[model samples]
Target: MTAKVSYLISKPVVTINKGTHSIDAAKKMAEHNIGSLIIMDNEKLIGIITERDIIRALGKGISLDLPVEEIGTTKNLITINENDSIYKAAELMAKNNIRHLIVTNNDGKLVGIISIRDLIRESHVLKALSVTSEQEWIGSD
Candidate 1:
């Protein structure tokens, strides 16, 4: 059985306003033990800032005091519905070279986020189940 994106998204999605400082955002991420934050603007999902974005901004000499919007990925915000298969999410991530994906409800509202780590965990679970099933079959007369 294929797992859905809903199975991977963490609850009560962590979000930050677009005007939030990069340093502050990083602090929030650390406090929450998360890698990314959904960027909001006027009660709308505008973009996302991830650890990778922060690293890139620092490497480029961008000021951490600047708003996260200035360094965040705004264009082409990749998203998938909550019911979409995890395989599809994996494909989207691989194609976009992104470690995270925003999940939206049917009404097009931000619901949650999924990370590559979540996908890897799900893959491991599936693989273990497959191995167990195969072993059972082999052992059966």
Candidate 2:
């Protein structure tokens, strides 16, 4: 059976308010061994912060005390619903060339996160299928 996004996404998402400091968010990411964190306010989706955001702040010499909103990428947050298939999620990742996606509930509340690593892990199963198909093709030929 094809895997689904829900199967791979990390739930009980660690989130932050946009007002929270980038350093604080970075600390949470490190503590959780996660690459990204959802930014929200009163249960509404707002933005996202990631390790990359923290790096960019360092590059700009921005203070660690600065709010994550000041360093986070605000535009083009790619989100997915829990019910969406992994196929669709993978397509979105390829289209956006992004490594992570924020998963949302039916009411659009942040629920979890999925990453390319999750999809690539699934590819191993698909690879096994491909090998089987290739062997079958060779035998037929």
CA lDDT, every model vs. true structure: 0.89, 0.81
- Name the regions of candidate 1 deviating beyond 4 angstroms: 124-141
**lDDT, residue 140, candidate 2:** 100
State the lDDT of candidate 2 residue by residue for 96-120, as single tens digits.
8888888877887777888888877
Instruction: State model 2's lDDT.
Output: 0.81
| Tens-digit lDDT track of model 1 for 1-141 | 667889997557899998899999999999999999999997899999999999998999989998988888888889999998887887799799999999999999998998988888886446755776799999996
Clashing pairs in 2: none
Worst 10 residues of 1 by lDDT: 123-132
